[model samples]
Target chain A: MDKEYQIQGTRMKFWMPKEVDHHKAAALRDQLDRLIEMHQIRELILDFSETEFMDSSGIGVIIGRTKTIGFYGGKVEAVNLSAQVKKICCASGLHRLINIREVAENDG
Target chain B: MTDKKTNHMHLYFDARSVNEGFARMVVSAFLTEMNPTLEELSDVKTAVSEAVTNAIVHGYSTEAQQVELICDRNEDELTVTVSDRGVGIADIPAAMQPFYTTKPEQERTGMGFAFMEAFMDEVRVESVPGEGTRVTMKKCIGRENGR
Candidate 1:
């Protein structure tokens, strides 16, 4: 809902909601790209604790963001992946480029 | 409610939560019905996340479009259909290649499909230029049919 995202050094956080469908991908990417441009972040830590679902379009976001971080010589880290989310991430071999973990939930 | 409609769920969301973390949650929930082993579930979740992310960033450019996720379960078999009406892929075969991507400036590994194939039993993709793309993936628990 917010256009601008806050970033500390290179780490940035964002949340994906349950209403995002085909129509919301553009705006989401715009926000993410804006955040990326503004922060020039090195390592992006994505917080996906609340998301309910994702599709092929969602995959594009990861690929696009990973590319963004890779351009900055940084990397993306996936955090708190649920089984559904992890299935796709693991299948895509995303771990080879980015690190994914369940640390946030462990702390909670 | 337990007759024939208990094994179906429809989810819709934006790219905001498709982050690597949220992707995890989505996958976890998807596997709950199957009661799969951790390793088996993990593999499925990762594959699903991969496809969803593609729809967000590449499919819709992760702007603000809606993502539709349909899950159907039959016994030990689960089928996930992730669809998006965003910028469709211009090249199907090229996109499926191991390391080919249009967003070179973005530093994409270009292996989204590769990973999907490695994790899920079957992956099917259908796209219409200027329309959208839909990816269908299926896997069965405890069968070890095909990966």
Candidate 2:
């Protein structure tokens, strides 16, 4: 509930917290799944602008959402990933599943 | 190779998801003595987080248990060991394989061992069925060449 959510028509955007681990991932999975079902969201954008640390659990959250939304012909895209988060994403082969925006020098 | 121990700490906490961050904080704070670079710090934190998570989720599996975390620093090298006395893994090799989680329903990508191995210079796992699992990882900090 502390996480922020934005909805614009069928697209939904979620702002991740400062840390994305198993504890947060479980909560995120529940909330995002509910939103996706209720709003019939076709496009999901996970904004990691504030995330400083993320482990495999973060990977699970993204993968879970990808599968959930993908079934409805929806897509998941990640934006503003920090270098540390990006490393985990790439290392887990998550880059191949969803569209991940490159991190800008100014973006955290 | 001066392996003289510089510092060491041990932590025992309930195997719960909430303590994951606590474990990371303790390890990172302990490593500050070496003045580790941001990258090195983040790598070890991620590796530690993964190990602790596995102990909570897979090892205990909704049962209340204890997770033991041990950290030691020898010169530029830091070693971390996370152990749990819960349901043990029967096959270590299969469990370490990427994307081979036993609990996919919970969205476990089975990448816990992979992340530990990826971020650390060395990773070793020891387990006995019906006993427990211990994951020990070592990383050399302040190295000119990156891992």
Candidate 3:
């Protein structure tokens, strides 16, 4: 399964499917770290286009990455949020922490 | 978020839906409208998942249980409730604190409540130890025009 991540330029993008609770959280974290290291990522834009949900562990992944990205003077952005998923991001204060732009944000 | 507000259909779910993200999206899609922003849907979905996950893992540790979801929509409010009859939390304040987790090895972020608090207009978590837990969240949809 190519659930790892894809890197290009300074943008380290990954797919976060919901159900990212404890069991898979560790794996997700490791995967993110490796990608950041591989491309020496300075900026990240996660595509949740395929993801349906997330949990505390998933939140941890983002927060931890925010810290990591901050150290490198990078930023994290999220695009393509379903209404329901957007609620969770707002509830988690992800909007404040990360740059949340819908697919249209990448447009004009 | 800058356009207008609209009401969403009331929703429900089971424990299985929360642990599995796709199951949750089934409900998320149910609420999407022509103008429904992705951020709006994501926030609600996350809060629902967090609540339901709490029901399954914390509320029903090993035994069979059910998670009940009810969504209510009015002119300006969208409320979601996730309830389960599992082991209840002994301390609410501590659990609400950032980074406080009952299971650390499980990689618990302990930010579930934090997220809910940030996303919803009102977030209340009530638990009766050995009984169950219920999370009620309310948000004002399409607050663009104060609708």
Candidate 4:
């Protein structure tokens, strides 16, 4: 809850926790969904540098938000996925739904 | 209660959504002595999360129930059992089938068991309708696999 989620113009960036389970997914979705709707955000960037574990619940969070913003032709991008997290995302077929990219430390 | 031949831990926590992450962390930390690879660790953690989430969400439906996590590990393998005393599953095979969920309204992917099966060496589900459900999973973590 103390983690900061940033929004700039049409782009929004949020940092995930070390573990993205059902508990964390719900709160993250609620807050981000509200921001997406309020700001009419077209792009969402999920930063996963701090995340080491994620389940289908985490996948649900991404898909839920992707659908919310998709109404406005907005897309979701996930970055800094650890190899393990990337494998889970790919197994869940999240890569097909969202843009998966690697983010350098210097680049926000 | 732990046996001398195998190291084990038993956890009982309120079936609150907040404890899902905690359950996974406990299991992951227990497996750390085996020095599992990141991928293996992730696989186990994700599977545990799914099992715990199912217990809290679909099983109890947020009714403030109790969930149990029992972990046992020897030098060769690790086993985890997640149980809940909530509304039990009537048909487990159908439940395990991909894309099938009791709570489709919540947009559940219904891939919880699938991931558990894929990641662990073996997965077993035991449920008695109106009684509860138990999911037991085991994975090899011997020298060849863990190291």
- Clash count of each predicted structure: 85, 0, 27, 0
DockQ of 3: 0.35
| Predicted candidate 3 versus true structure: per-residue lDDT over A1-108, tens digit per residue | 755466668876677764566446678788888889878998887777877656666767887888899898999888887665566566667789988887724433
Q: Pick by DockQ: which candidate is best?
A: 2
Evaluate residue A14 in candidate 2 and report its C-alpha lDDT on the 0 to 100 scale: 84
lDDT of 3 at A10: 84
TM-score of 3: 0.63
User: Once model 3 is optimally superposed onto the true structure by TM-score, how far is the C-alpha of residue B139 displaced, in angstroms?
Assistant: 1.0
Highest-TM-score candidate: 2
- Full candidate order by lDDT, most accurate first: 2, 4, 3, 1
Model 1 alpha-carbon drift over 4 Å, by segment: A1-108, B1-6, B17-20, B144-147
Give the per-residue lDDT of model 2 (tens digit) for B102-125.
Answer: 889888989999989999999999
Of candidate 3 chain B, the 10-residue stretch with the lowest lDDT total is B10-19
Tens digits of per-residue lDDT for model 4 on B1-147? 555546899999999987887898899899987778777787788889889999998777655689999999876589999999988999999999977887766768888998899888999999998889999999987544525
> Which portions of model 2 show Cα errors greater than 4 Å?
A1-3, A103-108, B1-5, B145-147
By lDDT, the better pick of 1 and 3 is 3
- Tens digits of lDDT, candidate 2, A6-40: 88799888898899999898788888889999999
Worst-scoring 10-residue span by lDDT in model 1 chain A = A17-26
- Best of the candidates, lDDT: 2
Model 2 has an lDDT value of 0.90
Candidate 1 lDDT at B80 equals 84
